[model samples]
Target: MNSSASSVVDPAAPPRSNPIRIGVSACLLGREVRWDGGHKRDRFVTDGLGRFVEFVPLCPEVESGLSIPRPTLRLAGEIDDPRLVFGDSGADYTEVMRSFARARLHTLADLDLCGFILKSDSPSCGLERVRVYGKGGMALRKGRGLFAAELAARFPLLPLEEEGRLNDAKLRETFVERVFAYRRWLDFVAAGVSLARMVDFHRIHKYLLLAHSPEHYAACGRLVARGKALSRAELREQYGELFMRGMARAATRGRHTNVLQHMAGYFKKQLDAASKDELHRTLDDYSDGLVPLIVPITLIRHHVRVFGLAYLEEQVYLAPHPKELMLRNQV
Candidate 1:
């Protein structure tokens, strides 16, 4: 559901450099792969999100040799034994599909992918809420796509999502944010960067992160501190786990904006009771789940900008990263 959370297009911005590698269904970009041989043609996915991610399109059925305009299909029976069949003609090629899924994953493994956007409800790529049944197409329980399930099982570290759900502004934004951060992690690994370097890398994100979940920001701090004694591999593995876990919390606009204000105060000499009380109200609103995490975060960011916190611009919270890594998003 690429339509789930449509991203806002920033036309005035320059093209983003060193784009994040994103795997997408061919149909989502208007490539004709549907059984009826048409496309979903998501402009937002192609143009908006496309701004920062270099999309790598995949058409499993076509790649698997299924005919275009063929019968529509759905998963039947258990998840592991999910069989894709032609609804009207009862044409079943379970073996062909299994092979296709495996082949696709092998190809995907080589790409320096940070995230994926699969076609939703497809037997091949739905990330969640997949249809399942009992022996036959009776009752359906939401599960993952056959190919998607295999890919997820194999590469548990990679981030995945569905086109259908990308329209939800919050989910779309959060997923993209995490993907960007993941790519940064991978870049660090490839460059032989150390944990201390990685620690410095994330320092710039300190206040911005607090905007989402203070618990996450605090946990990351502790995790970074623990990394002091670890090897490169250990630090990357541990930090990635902590980061992804924190990313899963789905920080709403309210929660982030509120905490952001308090964090901005971290740079200030002091905050009056009124200032503290206002921050408390924002946090209360967030804990109560009354607002989106980004809303408050946006406000907090505004304050940081207005006050001209010079150190923030220098990535002070993080260690030295690949020089370009820090500025990659700026492009």
Candidate 2:
């Protein structure tokens, strides 16, 4: 899950409760998750994302009892390939790391985590590009960290990143988008999604979905139309496949903001010129990075709830009858 986002209490952010749960490398947040008990302490992570995400700091090694200020570890074999060993002791900790990871996975299961920011180059948590050792003092291919490997195996659909990558704006946007999208999906599942519920769920996710795949968006609408013909089991399987496929597509700010602008048209007649113009300006400003897309989208959604057109709000996809389309009222 990679297109970026989130909500928390920050000066620039709208106040939010139940902030998205974000799994972080404990050391990175000054929690002393490192071998020697010193923390990484990232401000951008602590201040920037921490403002929105409920940080779940984890130190796999500490959990594994390797003690702080210990000797560094490395991948002794291959990445996604095998064997993790301690550099000095020649002690293989693969089984131990893997075992702890499994336990950690169970703990993570209940967190309703939207995403994770792993420590870079960590044997336990690096996301990508970790050094894989070949022979003595030799580095092989770059691969994922130990805990990261296990975590990815467990939650293949969850959004993840490393501190290094968050520096890039595009990556940040993708991570943000993916995490919230995951959150929305979780909300759908938690509500016991059915065909109608699924349609409603998709409606809220429409703008973000379109940013990923316009074609998929259209196809999803058709699939929703097939709800009556398909059973819940069938729909789940179908939608799950489509969801993964759509996620594989990349996201672009220009494309998203543009589609969002078109969506704003749904409210034009119902709103005054000042409100319309203001929203349009807000959308445009967000496109330029003056603010986040969430701010304007939230604004429109508020107006949408107040106004009563089903197409104007979350009802656009939730039809009256299986054959009754809410968008039919669209001007």
Candidate 3:
């Protein structure tokens, strides 16, 4: 538990005024920008997550001066430094694509993007497992797409995921959670970096970080404890890196159960025997995989409200993203 006596403010308060912005592949949003002039529209990306975020769509191939219905392109040569070339004629477009990516990434830096959704298996946008061909025309799925590589290099901390990978419930929830957390971090930085604000930020995110990574949570707590001795810039950079890295880690059943138990401690004196038994059963059910995460979380939320546990209420672990997304329903 956080030792700070400061009042905890809701981290989600900032984004309520400003829309969360996310960068995405245009084709995933139902744009006809693919090589075949047809879009690989993902309903989840278009109709589901689209409700909360404003997407900044980009098509690397089309935006890089390539025509619609253009010849197919593949990556060839060294896996580390592959060349983007036309499939039939092997016409190289490595420099053209790289140059475009550099300039376009510069423009995107100003958008304050919270996350990005890329096209899977694309020569220009795949996050990983992109096919790279050898001298004999044999291909290996070990290369990352050109534009995706650049985007990653430029914004190492930004939350990024391939559209196809979002089909998995756990991965989808983690990615969306990171997106909202990243936005909250951005909001914190924009407000100003001070020891007080840093302490408040660390206090609110304590449980959320513990579920993902207990090690990082402890590390961040130590940093905040001694923040007065460190420069503000050093504190901010280190904390931001640790926070995002922790969030990137997948929160497993055991870790989540640990957090739930820790949160339950707050309501120890307030709950009667039957209420406590009910909470324990819900936690056990969640641990045994008899119910989804939403079940246990809903009970905990109800207890928090009934007891008016201000600290637990401020914790982002209960409501990381919008409840309408139902990310916790499946996981």
Candidate 4:
């Protein structure tokens, strides 16, 4: 994690009661299990996000019976259907890796994972832009690792990102937000599904959904409205799909500004003229890139408490992830 992000958790902020379960590349946690017996340990994944999440680490190459300090492997052949081959020996491990991944992912599905963090540019775990060499020995950075591709195909809605990409402030924020949200959804389902409970979940996440995609928010609202008519299984399936799709979209500045303005309306009858002016100015500053999102969010949260806006106080958008991550400070 960046130093700025590391310092954001308020001392008095309510601690999360439940830990989010996430899959991660084993080497990211400082395990010496890479092909060369060296780890690509990422402090952001291990020290920052790790504080809030329980990682289920796996090293495909090592777990598949490959020796440490083994000959390096590379993806070769067609981009869509690459073969995992030793860099120097031309030995093939494609089928072995695929079979191992299929079995491992099936096991993971039972683990109730909310997200996954893969190692970047790994032959076994990179999520994107992995180099695939052509028959003539030229490399193209358009392929995903075999295991990463399998995991995605198996759990299409599961939040997944590479440790390398998590270095970006925006991507890191979105990934952390989605993981926590997914964990909440899982807990909701585990508590037993009901139309009334579905409505309650939708209500709390309204503005959070709006920040990502207005169309998805509308679709999800409509889905909840039909809750009493649809069977429990059908309602759960459809709602989960829409919820995941909506959060999968990056929350852009324009969309967030609109939501922030809408939230500010709740405090209009409660704020004095000066306070109102300050709120609007903060929102405008955030919208104009002159201030971080945390500025408007912090002000709105204060107003919500002062005015006792119960509904607004409960909104997940106000505290999507742990404040300690300081994700909004970056965006």
Q: Quote model 1's TM-score.
A: 0.76
Q: After superposing candidate 1, which stretches have Cα over 4 Å from the reference? A: 1-17, 79-81, 88-92, 211-219, 267-308, 314-331
- Please give the lDDT score at residue 106 for candidate 4: 93
Name the regions of candidate 2 deviating beyond 4 angstroms. 1-19, 237-241, 244-250, 264-331
lDDT of 4 by residue, 1-331 (tens): 1122222222222236555889999999999998788998999998898887789999999998899989998999999989989999989999999999999899988788999999999878999999999978899998899899999999988999999899999889888888888888888888888999999989988999899989999999998887889999999889998998899899999999999999888768677789878987898899999999999988887777666677787788988888888899999
Provide the global lDDT of candidate 2 against the true structure. Answer: 0.70
Give a tens-digit lDDT track for model 2, residues 1-331.
1112222111112125445788888888988757766888887789777766688888888888888788888886755575778878979998999999999889889888878899888877887778888766687558788889999889877888888877766666566656666666666566675988878766755765677778887788788888889988787667755764565466666766767777777767777889888887888788887776557656765665555435544432121111111111211
* Better by lDDT, candidate 3 or 1: 3
Measured with C-alpha atoms, the lDDT of residue 307 in candidate 2 is: 59
- Pairs in steric clash, model 3: none
Model 1: per-residue lDDT, tens digit, 1-331?
A: 1223223222112224445788888999999889898988886689777765678988878888878988887777666566767677767767787777787788877788888889888877788877875564584757676778777877777878887776776676656666766676676677776766776766756644654467877877887787767777777777777666676566555554454445656544444577556656765665566754444444443444444544543432222122222221221
* Candidate number achieving the greatest TM-score relative to the actual structure: 3
Candidate 1, after superposition: displacement of residue 18 in Å? Answer: 2.9
Q: For residues 1-331, could you state the per-residue lDDT of candidate 3 as single tens digits?
A: 3334344334554456666899999999999999999999999998999998999999999999999999999999999989999999999999999999999999999888999999999999999999999999899999999999999999999999999889999899989989999999988898899999999999999999999999999999999999999999999999999999999998888899999999998886678899989999999999999999999888988777776678898998988888888888998
Put the candidates in lDDT order, highest first.
Answer: 3, 4, 2, 1
- Cα lDDT of candidate 1 equals 0.65
Q: Candidate 4: misplaced stretches above 4 Å?
A: 1-18
Worst 10 residues of 1 by lDDT: 319-328
What lDDT score is found at residue 232 in candidate 2? Answer: 80
The C-alpha TM-scores of every prediction are: 0.76, 0.74, 0.95, 0.93
